[model samples]
Target: MSTLRMAAVSAPFGRDLEEDFARIGALIEQARGDGVGLLVLPEACLGGYLTDLDGAAELPPAFRVGGPEIARLAGLAGDMVVCAGFCETAGAKTYNSAVCVTGDGVLGVHRKVHQPLREDASYAAGDRFTAFDTPVGRIGMQICFDKAFPEAARAQALDGAKIVCSLSAWPTSATNRHPDPAQDRWTRRMDLFDRARALDNQLVWVASNQFGAFGAMRFAASAKVVDPGGEIVAWTEQREGLAVAEFDVDAVVDAARGGMDFLRDRRPDTYPATGGTPYVAA
Candidate 1:
């Protein structure tokens, strides 16, 4: 498929597995009706995110990567390639993970490597970034705070990912509350990161975030689809909606990199091997 119809969702999910599946089913049916081949859902859409970033909040129930929950998700996905976040279990360890699936079964899985605030207290960190083949394209996955780091996305890009899906459960400022969520600093940062990552990697970027309030957290529902040129083609700004767009993925990526290829002109050799010393005035 040359032209891919894709969507990034901004919707709320919670602790109830049944309720979450209901919401997910409805979203998938809606996307199928719209002929979307790739659907990206918010982080923790399976079991919900931490009630609060503080260490005191209870962790969500964890399911194995090959567990029945993922199988159910795959069955629901049918022909559409869907990506959603969930709490994954591996024996004694639990990871905040994202999985890509279809009726055919799982395509890719990413355990979010970066944890924000006190998140580390609840879940163990993932060690690697990987991109895998899917019906839609070569896709890389990242959770909320992972996108804040350029290296995370770059690693995937370098590994031959053509599209990146960023699933987020990001919330607005916990302390400095903003009357309008659209103007919140955290919301602004999320949007900036989405665009910057797309432009920096010259790949299609689909960002999905949680909407509404869950416990003490108020989410920033700025889900969007950004082109390789760093332009937001579709956005659900501060609302619960699906940001959808159709484009020729290869064509746009080629166009973006044609004039001045960011990846082609690399200076990795000049950069420090490890964290370089802080620059001092000469």
Candidate 2:
């Protein structure tokens, strides 16, 4: 893969799963027609987000791992790689997870390592992260609020991920941004955390967030593709729209090691995770 053309589709939320999914199908087809090789949808696009999301038992069992929900989208990859935000039930716990699907089948599932501050009332926090090799580039995902934690991005970058795509439903509130502190503030501190992650990690980043109002929740975060150099290559309006960008794999290398060499001068010896203590965002 010489270059990566990423597309993010921002659609409805909550009870509009089927409709949004159908819209995504059309978007994928349209993108393919326009020569798009990599496509991504908004966060929790399957079960919907920030409203009254039902428990794991309500979803069809087949959609669990090898289910119809996964199959439906898997069948859409016409020689292109597809990633969508969806719900996952592993063991007795359910998580807000995402899957990467190749044209052949499901390549891998990424359990979001870091969860939102108020996410405890919903999905259980995932303890792992996964990065996979793709035809376009090495890719990894950190759903929504996961971008706020530098360690979450660092963990993936250290594992050989040149690019990271985060499916988010950022809030429109202030103070705690990126759905942190359990507040609805996507529009308030929208770019602060995202830009920090891209600039510090030096990897191509796609932060696709939800839009429109569903029930009492409204997601205003725009879709953006940030370069490894911390510069936003493409960003959509704070309200709604689709964002697309073409990223060369080499750009990430140059940004991370060249003039934007922030990671190289880090003093890791001074900071260590001595205990498994939970992190609290202020």
Clash pairs, candidate 2, are 62-67, 63-67, 170-186, 171-185, 171-186, 172-185, 172-186, 172-187, 173-185
Q: Considering every candidate listed, which one attains the maximal TM-score?
A: 1
Against the unseen true structure, what C-alpha lDDT does each candidate score? 0.92, 0.70
Question: For each candidate, C-alpha RMSD in Å?
Answer: 4.6, 5.8
How high is the lDDT of residue 218 in model 2?
A: 64
Can you tell me which runs of candidate 1 are displaced by over 4 Å?
A: 274-282
**lDDT tens string, model 1, 76-164?**
99999999999999988989999999999999899989989899998999998878999887889999999999888888887778899
The best candidate in terms of lDDT: 1
User: Cα miss at 101, model 2 (Å)?
Assistant: 0.9
**Compared with the true structure, what per-residue lDDT tens digits does model 2 show for residues 152-216?**
77777766677788888765653344543223444545577777887777778888888776544
Model 2: residues with Cα > 4 Å off, grouped in runs: 52-62, 174-185, 274-282
TM-scores of all models?
Answer: 0.96, 0.84
lDDT of 2 at 252: 55
